[model samples]
Target: MLIDEVPERAVRRAGAAIELPEGLLVLDADSGEFGRMPKPVADAKIRGLSFDGARMVLVGGRGTCLLRLADGEQCWYGIPEERYDEHADLSPDGRTIAILTCDEENAIISLLDPETGRRRDIWSDPGTASHECEIRWSPAGRTIAATYMIWDDEMDDDALSTVVVDAADGRVLAGPFIRTHLLGGWLTADLLSFREEYDDLHRLQRLDTTTGEVITGPTIPGRVWAAVAGRHVHEVDELEDHHAEDTTFYTTDIGFADRRPLFTLQPKVEVRYFFLAAGVSLPPSR
Candidate 1:
């Protein structure tokens, strides 16, 4: 591994903020900061961020939109006025991007080229409702996993399901598995980690993707709020700053294909008043 470098300065710039959108973020690899772009909100909301290192894509309302960072000018490529409003992901080569699409009534998974801006609908599942969460891609770029839920009128509540799709043909590979709430998820070549939300508590589970088996027990406890995994570090949130003076190591894949941001995002907030406001929630004092 290359020598770890000092953390670079963070750039906190507000782009477009949309309601009920995914909180996906993109970062500049060199500066370890978010990509500077003009966020003009249309009918779409950006829910997740994925990259081939050089190119960044935002997935959310209205399908997957492409973002390119090259000669200092940030450019965006998108479908003209057609909205997809769900989770979107990119292939490993950065040539094709995928999205779980709907227009408040019909739903399908679509793919598009970032450079040419041409789109094709690959999979249409009419049974899929418009209420699914973010979509995740397998590390090999061959499959996609998404949360699927259906209402059983006899039970009177929604039953959750998870589905994995074959990227090549949009074939259902694994689930429709029952789950409660899926918060965030990531995939490795062999391992898959996911956070599940239950009531007010969050649980993290690690799974073996090949066998579709759980490797660790559920409901890991603590105030662990933030987590990002790589080959070098599995950084978890702690009450106190652990690496204040030390450099953080970032692992990289060859061919510059899979490059992640080298710096961790740190946000400092000052809360002036706590329990005085009516029905206002406050963060615990550090």
Candidate 2:
């Protein structure tokens, strides 16, 4: 390994990611602390990972994990700690995990108790409703926000809709509403932000979980961002075709392409950088 030309021998499977001897690492420049992500859960590629103070959820293609981590490394489970691993959505309180599992014949959402690994069928799809992304806990920890709908098969995007389930009993509280994006947010502790069509463009709208009300926010092309704190360190990926072509012969609007402000994006390549949010260095994949 080379830390600015200081050479050192690196062992096999100990670098920066799995499957290729590479592992993920975390760095907090403000605190001057840096470390690699603990080897993937049981060495499985993490399809999704999120931490919200009390709970840590790791979602993968083969399996999933529900555990509480202290200081990002310590595993805190008083029980046997083996059965809570499943493809599930972790509740904000770290108590319940809502998993949509199916057999060759049926598909249902199973409300799972991570501590005991006990599960109960909360909801079932009569048609062909399968789960999609954005399965998460509301900031208040009372509602489970997820998306599911009928489609052709595994790779098809059709009839995508959002549902807010009651975490306690798995009751459908609100929505089966049409949504174009599998995107939602906890804009506030009680507000759940979702995307919907607003006129000719898509907009971000917040739903008040308590009052069944709605409030619209900014519009986006596909995605947008806002900085809560700290600053982001970025690397540009400009297209070779991007040059002094003020008259590039296009009948469309300008965007975050070559000459963009937020960040430069290129086709067929990923631009991974560092997002120093509140101290944690978030991995940006190119």
Candidate 3:
């Protein structure tokens, strides 16, 4: 269902949520009913949803807050004095939260404790700025993959890079890999899928974080809008008719086999921001 004037949306394994101008429209997976939950903080933006759809992270003009869907319980992060343009992701185990924040000079990734409202910076890179600054936690919750737009003073342009770090102590495990963008969640604890420009076409590729091995996957037929759960690839294709377009959201294995079409959007709408709960099965589109 396309919602007019909705600015943001997030999809989980069991349901989905839309950010309306008034409030958050939540689709309850268990009841198969829709409900509206007032934003915990005024003008807060939905950063991410937990795997089970029980909790969500929101960032607002004030700070970031964690909302419990069961009772609307709220836990605000301790860093209210810091930047407001932060992005957050809840760990799979529901114990830790990853927060990505950046300023004009540096990019920072930190871990937060929901219960105690404590935060610790895990990694910080000076002289680099973030583009999307999206972070994804591995299935085991042991590592994080982050996207950044690094400024290249020599090239006089910004370059895309993906960095993988240890979730525990902020050790660099794999990258600051240049010119690669993370495709989806981790396929495994060590494997990540990404895309790189190859002869003017965007081609899917896989990286083994442990061994520094790279493997080229299938060539994408159209532009890949998003990838989720390391298996489903959301693609947008311009139709032959100029006035309309088609957006195909499908799921496939790591090898791009056993392809399945989950849903398609005709006369495509511009999706400015959308996120899928990583490592979770998306309920079949109804």
lDDT of 3: 0.66
Cα distance off (Å), candidate 2, residue 199: 7.9
User: lDDT by residue for model 3 over 1-286, one digit each (tens)?
Assistant: 4433333433232255545455565666665544455555676777777877777777765566777766667877655354544677889888998877766677778788887878888897753434355678887888998876777566677776778999999998887877777776577767887775233556677888878888887766544444555565555456323554554556677777777776554436554444555534564654
Q: What's the lDDT for residue 63 in model 1?
A: 44
Spell out the clash pairs found in candidate 2. 16-22, 16-23, 17-22, 17-23, 270-286, 271-286
Q: After superposition, how far is residue 214 of candidate 2 from its true place, in Å?
A: 3.1
Per-candidate TM vs. native? 0.58, 0.57, 0.80
Evaluate residue 266 in candidate 3 and report its C-alpha lDDT on the 0 to 100 scale.
40
Off by over 4 Å in 1: 1-27, 33-44, 59-63, 71-83, 103-106, 126-132, 152-155, 158-160, 180-183, 195-202, 221-286
Candidate 2: how large is its RMSD? 9.0
For model 1 the local lDDT of residue 8 reads 28
- Model 3, residue 99: what's the lDDT? 79
lDDT score, candidate 1, position 29: 45
Clash pairs detected, candidate 1: 22-47, 61-85, 62-83, 62-84, 62-85, 63-84
How would you encode candidate 2's per-residue C-alpha lDDT over 1-286 as one tens digit per residue?
Answer: 2212222222221111111134443332333233445443654333233333233445444345643333344232222222222235555455676665554443456676766766777665532334333455665667776655545354454555566778777788777656433343444456665665333655556677788786665543333321111111222223324442221111111212332233222222321212112213333322
Positional deviation of residue 262's Cα in model 1 after best superposition, in angstroms: 10
Whole-model Cα lDDT per candidate? 0.44, 0.43, 0.66
